[model samples]
Target chain A: MAKFKKSALKENDGISAPETTSIAAISKIKEKRRQKKSTSDLVKAILNGNITALSQAITLVESKNSEHLEQANAIIKACLPHANKSVRIGITGVPGVGKSTFIESFGSYLTNIGKKVAVLAVDPSSSITKGSILGDKTRMEDLVKDKNAFIRPSPSGTSLGGVARKTRESIILCEAAGFDTIIIETVGVGQSETAVHSMVDFFLLLKLAGAGDELQGIKRGIIEMADAIAINKADGKNLKQAKLAKVEFNRALHLYPVKTSNWQPKVMTCSAIENEGIEAIYSMILEYKKLTIDNNYFYSKRNQQNKFWLIQTIEEQLKNDFFTNSKIKIELEQQLELIENNKTTPFVAAEYLLGLKT
Target chain B: MAKFKKSALKENDGISAPETTSIAAISKIKEKRRQKKSTSDLVKAILNGNITALSQAITLVESKNSEHLEQANAIIKACLPHANKSVRIGITGVPGVGKSTFIESFGSYLTNIGKKVAVLAVDPSSSITKGSILGDKTRMEDLVKDKNAFIRPSPSGTSLGGVARKTRESIILCEAAGFDTIIIETVGVGQSETAVHSMVDFFLLLKLAGAGDELQGIKRGIIEMADAIAINKADGKNLKQAKLAKVEFNRALHLYPVKTSNWQPKVMTCSAIENEGIEAIYSMILEYKKLTIDNNYFYSKRNQQNKFWLIQTIEEQLKNDFFTNSKIKIELEQQLELIENNKTTPFVAAEYLLGLKT
Candidate 1:
């Protein structure tokens, strides 16, 4: 028995479902529609706070079509001024940590408090399997039905960098469409966490009780990046354990250096299903916002994140250019072979490849 | 009093001397001599275990002259056949953590036990100030005077990437010159650690007693990168506190996720001046080496590191090509300004630059 049930909730809907097109298929359909829509008309609707237009614009951003690139750029530029006003929060947890359950409850809670919430996931692993999105949608039924909340599953069939870029652009579209709070959800297992961390204003980590070797359960750098850690599934029998976990977490957090934000990362316990501690978590986020804003760290961090992603994007493109080069690919293999055989040092080999670019 | 007295040993030497021209200037004079030496002559001398030629070739590697590049590459190519037999070790600690004292003692101990130790420092920060190199050489009196040991200070007036390349190339030259042990040292405060970590077979971090807020002094990912953490200055009155710090470090390390190497990082108390715990630290490294070599992890890890540097080097060169472009440089600033004003997303800005490149 895991501390929190994630996939277990998917099977609890009590009915065998009929065949449905996967999120990947849904993306392809949207991709088809994106080509038919004019960039100006689509951007106009998105800027006018139309959710449908915002969704389509995001689809265009996620599309692989060469024709969609210019259009996606145009829409993002049009929506830029309308974006960045929202509190962009990144949430992550390992499987069985009840991340979906927590988000469903938290998203609904935000909407109830007169906030327009958008829940988007960055699942680069799903890019290969094309799985998790369908599971995510089923677990998020309550929030899916809530009119004030929008739950978009992870975009599939691309690299982490590509998926992250799409999700980041989608945040802009959602913010422009009047969603005041954007929740970027990612599995705690991968590079997606860092991607989400770089784009969001606040990064949240969800953990389970019992102290369960937190180091083993979550990825190495994930804990370090978290702005706050919520010990979820802290209800009834698990409440005491959850409270102990809070103490344990506080100790662990203190071991880390002071974060660049200067705000100490808060650790708290909550039961998403019981709706306990949900308000406290929201209040924590607000408190963080107040502190960072008061210290001018909020805007500075956002700008820093912006600059980070810009450089990251450029580096990604540059890497792709070099690796994707037909000649360089062949040359790289030869250089690696030479390095392995101790015939050439890596630096000299790298120089040869750089020389080849001319 | 601090847990360690690094500069105390220096003061004990009892000599306040006039400022001398730095090691970097000495490198340039050697670089001029390197131009006259034939590549074959240099390689022959290096392969015959001549320290002077090895140093000269390294100076050529560190040289900025375009003429030196061809000769440097040629020398490296000639030496590659004889290199890669040594065990490369990386050591790091904050400024006051007795790094120099520890290294001095450790290097001398290795020489006493019939090991040819090559001590090299990777100080990217030193490149900026053009300091620390002379200080390091002076502090390492015992090791510097040892005929069996070779010590090189950090190369100055270059980017970290450039310095790293020079240092890595120097490792090959040193190994070819029959130095069976290579120690790459770096300040505990910068990007140099990651560079050192990738090139070395083992990474060691030196810490002080009483916990003393390690997180504040060291980078976050660095602790995770350490294969062993030695609490230096564990002597006299500091012994109990050092033991306490050893326990604390172990506990803090256990809070993080497991490493890919499947090796548990060891924490131990050591006294450099007292020459205590030195053998245990060395034994731990040998034990690790034995285990890894037995499991074939040693070779596999080396190959992985080799591939990492190769790819990393290519990426650095690619980024330099794009970023150093006069047009892209100007465009990048404009795009960054737009991103700051929230007039365009980072992805869109990156795309425009990519478009311009094409």
Candidate 2:
């Protein structure tokens, strides 16, 4: 294990460093990168598969620092041709379903098989509290130590769904960086899980054996989107219960129409802690890849996901822009008061507000 | 019982007619009523509290017919001062949890006690299919026929959460109609339940006994927001299991912080089919009302709900405007194609499409 002193780690090249010069240099380079024929440069880096540059470029796109966005656009344009080659997997489960533990074990398995893996954690905790564990690297210490693995925790300070947009952009960067497997792990199954699922190629759901609350899962529709379900902690005393859960889940999954991919949704049991059945899971993924690629469904699915992301991004930005506009603020406040007073119906207030805009 | 054919009903009153002539006549009469604005007229109307007029007003608000919407706004404004007197209760449960049965029994109990009861259903399923068991009068056949009970099924054609907005508007109409107890029944427990919950004074979650889906409920957080939980089908062999489930739910409810209203959530078992425990449910609601009103939390909570609806309405309109614009449509298609070809990243595509507006 390589350990460095906190002071040493705070040096220019270290993780904790302020890196005033490099920060300044990066900004300057970004500005210059903006002025140059950025599209061509972006194209070059993306074709050459530079992951760091791709990630930095994505950050520029997501940044509130408006000045860097244009340059980021150029870089994305350059990288466009090399993107969409890898499998984008979104994994979700309940809070205590051992999501991180499963990812750690699963991710380590992928790395050992000569695959470059990137894990991005998309925590849905509110930005204000800053309470997210972002414990991917901590949980998957072995994978983090491997040269073939790259793990990034949830980027703090954004909406749960908004964090997913950044993660999607980061995936392109990881692919350009030579990672073949990109796994996005969301904290729990909810609206955020749906958001992540919409942006990925394969959606995996992890479950615990004998979840005392089965109806909760059915109501949320988490099981419906799942392409594959793995009942984790399926060892020792839990084995029979895990088998029973697998059967129950299979019955539920049957209710959904066959997915567009035409692949029969699969359910299996695994012990992330015991590192058992990890190889079978990988084999299933490979089978899925071969089946989809043979039918030319892989490229088409990615295309659809990209379009979904495009529209979702536009909708989110437009919402923020309209609500945050200085001009609409007063009228909105007044209308809210009217609504509170029961002097105006919401529909009427909405119409009046929109009329004000025109 | 009063029975009238659709045509006969339409002929009796100008407001019920679908023809332009009757619509014009109703509008003219409404205009005259608006201009007079006599103090006696206002007081008489408030004191009398016509339930039929209130029902018609709510229909006008939910109607897609643009002219009806204007009339609805006028009616709501006139009735505003008389509103806010009702004890608004929102009840939600997973499909087949006997939501309608509970409402039927509960509404009957209230009406029998000299309280006028109005039941409105918010069905998200109406949005996509436009095919709903509208006015599921059959589900509450007895209550529907009761002179003191009013039953309105879901209004068709709107988004999931958006449907609840109309229901909220209808609740105000119901209150003005002199219905002192208004129960808003949601068809399912999902996102729509949250919408119903935010607009009501008290929210009740119904569950089945011995179904063993408790873990599933926790995952979705439906049980968390519940002000009161009732394990239905508590008669017969399931009675013991219902009691056990109530104990488990009570423990789970304790994990949530005391609500802002300072009301301790309660759990009970009921047999809605047998009409047992309905009175107990009513008494619990009354207790909640008295406590919150004395603490000055009741009106304040309603005010917050009104504000939430106002902002939500504006946001929905803005999104609709952006998506429906002819100019945006053309550019959106072009950017989607660019994304499909991998010629642009989704973030860049969004920025470009939005930038085109300027």
Candidate 3:
């Protein structure tokens, strides 16, 4: 019964030890200094590539306080000139596809090749799950510790639109901090992929070799949006299937019309954990960059994205205002019931509701 | 050239014969009576299967006159209980894919099987080309004369949304007129296909076997929407290629996840000009109807589509109202210019514009 003995009680780290009492005073002074910093001082620090300033600016951007929002908008406007210099890449895959591993290996490779990398996420479900995807730093332990890399979990928000807006602004902050490459990671499940695709220059879909067809479980319209597909975990017993998947995907990709960028989307096999094939993927992206830039699509696409976002924001706000109106919400339910009973058509009901809003 | 000389001394139909002058008096009286008839009477006549009344009601729906729209809404509300009884099938194909011939053959089959067919179109380009798709009665000469069939060209509207609304309203008129099969046809280019897809129970894509791969010229996102793909012009030398295309398309269709309808989309070869394979297509639709009905998806899907239309109309109207505001328009341009100069972000610009509107 006594095969194991009880270990000695350890000091609780949750409670501050007596010797660390002086640290509290330093924290209060630091907080006071942060409060005293002006908007211009924050902007200058961010432009000077100060990581702490960048993090603080992003926090302001993600804040709910109207005062913070005003400051954040001012900071972003100041940083706008320095943005759009980075190659923003969006990477997405299902839960078990090793997205963090891929990013760790690929991002580390970028830093090694003398590129500054920033990783952000746009998980719409982060609010409910409380940032499940990248909340744990141990998932990408090495990349998190790398000096040239900045990793931020998805910002929690009440809606995908809010979260996407935060991540997009964070991208500007990251870019102004002298990062040349930005990676936005979204889970393969929701509307987040489309939001990510709109903001990024190149979209890479991460996949795993299934037991059967390689294209079995792809979300609709995703292959069309992807600039490349990387089959992660192509190591040990999975290598052969991954190669076959690459060939299959290549054939499938050819069936699509030539992209507007005139750069054919590429498919490759990579072992993120084993650190295999990451460099080839990077070269492929660079090649795509060269082609799209030469063809004048890079700048034009970014301009289109800007216009799209402007219209998208306005339309979303318009819809929110209408649907959230006290009278419209109640009358909308009645119209739907009328629609259910076939007493009114959707068009007629919509007209009635619009009149109510006015 | 002499043989082709103008036919000698034919009485001019445009000027009318002297004896027909009496008929003009009767036309005036009939016009007066039509004007005097109330919306309820028009609704009653449509429910009684009066083709003239149905056509007049649809014209009102397509009219831009405010008074006509009011009357149209009244008639539609009265007819709403009689609508939603027919099966709506959407047919789309690129120009020169023989869309008219396919509809002629397929629609005639439905009529022969004792079904009343109403053929409508949603050509967004109709405004520019003056209703190019079905404006010519000769395109479906036989069907145009069939008492069991009602055909309407795409309504000419400045916006696709307006045209789509007219067609949708006309569908109600046709259904109330006792048409059991509603066929909505759209050209394969632009946004018309999506509009048509949202309104129909079954979406059929018409394709021609290309010189190379059969999938070479398909517009993006179309194959995923298709419930069936019929390869036309398969009577001549194209037959062999059409069969090969069927096999290729079958494989491609399998790659898509199962539809919410739980019906596997089919690929078939049909010679519309030769009138072959028409009945088989009908049988396939009946089978799909049976499966969906058994699974309770048929009613659920219709309900979902109704809710979708209601929300869609509200959103479109909201955007229209916002963008059409004169003050917002000028400010929007200014904000865009600022965005181009990197002085403002899309989010901030949108906020400023929205604030100005309020």
* Best model per TM-score: 3
Regions of model 3 farther than 4 Å from truth: A1-36, A128-130, A209-211, A235-240, B1-36, B128-130, B209-212, B234-240
Using all chains and alpha carbons, the TM-scores for the candidates as numbered come to 0.85, 0.73, 0.88
Chain B alone vs. reference chain B, TM-score for every model: 0.86, 0.82, 0.90
lDDT score for candidate 1 against the true structure: 0.85
Tens-digit lDDT track for model 1 on B226-289?
Answer: 9999999999999998888888789878876767777889998899989999988988998888
In candidate 3 chain B, where is summed lDDT lowest over 10 consecutive residues? B12-21
Judged by DockQ cut-offs, the docking class of candidate 3 is medium
Cα-lDDT of candidate 2: 0.76
Q: Model 1 over residues A195-302: C-alpha lDDT tens digits?
A: 899889899999898646554545667778989999999998999988888887887788788887898999999999988899999999999999999999999998
Whichever of 2 and 3 has more lDDT, that candidate is 3
Native contact fraction per model: 0.82, 0.74, 0.85
How high is the lDDT of residue B139 in model 2? 80
- The candidates score, on chain A by TM-score, as follows 0.87, 0.80, 0.91
lDDT of 3 by residue, A1-358 (tens): 3444355654545865577457889899889977756899999999999999999999999999999999999999999999989999999999999999998999999999899999999988876457657776787888899999999999888788899899999999999999999999999657889999999999999999888877777887799999999999999999999999999999889988889999899999999999999999999999999999999999888888888899999999999999999899899999999999989989999989999886
> At residue A197, what lDDT does model 2 achieve?
82
